[model samples]
Target chain A: TQLLEQSPQFLSIQEGENLTVYCNSSSVFSSLQWYRQEPGEGPVLLVTVVTGGEVKKLKRLTFQFGDARKDSSLHITAAQTGDTGLYLCAGADSNYQLIWGAGTKLIIKP
Target chain B: GAGVSQSPSNKVTEKGKDVELRCDPISGHTALYWYRQSLGQGLEFLIYFQGNSAPDKSGLPSDRFSAERTGGSVSTLTIQRTQQEDSAVYLCASSLFFMQGILSVGELFFGEGSRLTVL
Candidate 1:
């Protein structure tokens, strides 16, 4: 089974702090996606990166796909309380299935 | 619906009982997927349906778990003799289509999910 290991399973920071969450795997992926989920809701896609060394920024969140396509990272700049949630990373396997990471729970204190 | 829809947002059932979760994908989406999420864990793929092709059941944990998508629109996931381990959020998602080539990636639209609690 393909596994995506995410780092810093739990994170807590004050407002305006910056945080980064990383997802690593031994298997290379064709594409990687980042999602943020709130309580009582399914995850919402934040961004998708397809190429190696790709970077996409959405508002305060920036996502980077590793040069080897075996890892990805999400960086939040000037984090706000609204940025608090579970951040997940998913990669597309050869079978077109999404292999997901355990995710990082982020709490931004206001 | 504009987005994927799941029924019985929350369900509390006995350990030996059976439960069925429903998923209604967005109109015109051809790819549907089922996943289970335990507390503090990532999404675990359960089943996948694409168009009229054979459904992928490889991810189903056991024979007790089965799912079916009818007429290419709505799908149902059934768990028989539910166990405490089956308690989790059942999520359904749909994409316009499955990834076709090396570079194409389908973006999945997810529902609010059905939270099942087995006692």
Candidate 2:
């Protein structure tokens, strides 16, 4: 079983639309990280939230860590075709190792 | 400086054969990690090396899989008697430090993974 679960395994939306992807887990985390992976490449870090209830914004993308430290969410505003890719959230478990979610595949149609 | 670099960008081997994948971490980094990504799946942790101490091999899947980091720099992951299910992209990452208790959560720099195919 996956320690972290991501909602909406796949998302397809029109350009200019907004979307939010959720990552939930039963275990608390010391830090949660978000990454984006494109075709033929490894995942690139987008953001890392260490504090609970922390909110970080990177241009049109916003990431929020749950107050309980067991969940996180990614919100994209005015999504564009360039934003299409696989979004992954990973949390540092009790062992201080990363536990990953299945991932949310986002596709923005023109 | 350059990020992590992996060798044999793509490899193909028949079942029951052996394969080796290499990873060169960033300079001066004390931590290195190996992860495997299969089709339609998330990145699975394989192993981690910290400084010159013992590596964290808890994530290794089976006895057929093994890895070693030499001189605290380059790492090689070897899979003996590979199976078709082992086909996947193997990724390598490195960080400034691997300390967990000290809260040195350094961001990992990942290489463009090496794709392995077992037929």
Candidate 3:
């Protein structure tokens, strides 16, 4: 089974602090996506990176797809309280099925 | 619908009982997916449906888990003999289509999810 492993399962930081979360896997993917989920709600898509070494930015969040397509990262610059949520990375396998990482729970305390 | 919708936002059932979760994808969406998320965990793919092709059941954990999509729109996932391990948030998502032939990857719109608890 293809597995997407995420690092730093939990993070608690003060508002304005920057943090980075990672997702890694041994298998290559056609694309990778980042999602943020608030409590009691399903995940909302943040961005999708299809090319190796690609980077996409959305407001204060920056997402990077690894050169090998086997990993990805999400960096939050000056995180705000609204950034508190679960961040998930999903890779599109060769079959077009999504392989999801366990996710990182980020708490940005104001 | 403007977005994916799931019914029975929360459910509590006995350990041996059965439960059914429903999903209504956005109109015209050709792809649908089912996933389970434990507390503080990522989504676990359960099943997938695309256009009229056969559904993907590879991610289902056991035979007791079954899902069906009717008329290529709404879907229902049924769990039999529920166990505590089955307690989790069941999420449904839909996309326009798979990204293979498309120029860009499609975004998946997810429902609020149905939270299931087995006791």
Best by TM-score: 1
lDDT of 3 by residue, A19-72 (tens): 999999999998999999999999999999999999999999999999999999
How would you encode candidate 1's per-residue C-alpha lDDT over A4-75 as one tens digit per residue? 999999999999999899999999998899989998899998998988999999898889999999999999
What's model 1's overall lDDT?
0.92
lDDT of 3 by residue, B79-115 (tens): 9999999999999999987445653447899999999
How do the predictions measure up, each by TM-score? 0.96, 0.95, 0.95
| Backbone clash tally (model 2) | 0
State the lDDT of candidate 2 residue by residue for A20-102, as single tens digits.
99999988988999999998888899999998999999999999999999999999999999999989999887666788898
From the highest lDDT down, the ranking of the candidates is 3, 1, 2
Q: Interface Cα RMSD for candidate 3?
A: 1.6
Worst 10 residues of 3 chain B by lDDT: B97-106
Judged by DockQ relative to the true structure, which candidate is superior, 2 or 3? Answer: 3
Clashing pairs in 3: none
DockQ, per-model, please?
A: 0.75, 0.68, 0.73
Q: Among the candidates, what TM-score does chain A have in each? A: 0.98, 0.97, 0.98
By DockQ rank, best first, the candidates go: 1, 3, 2
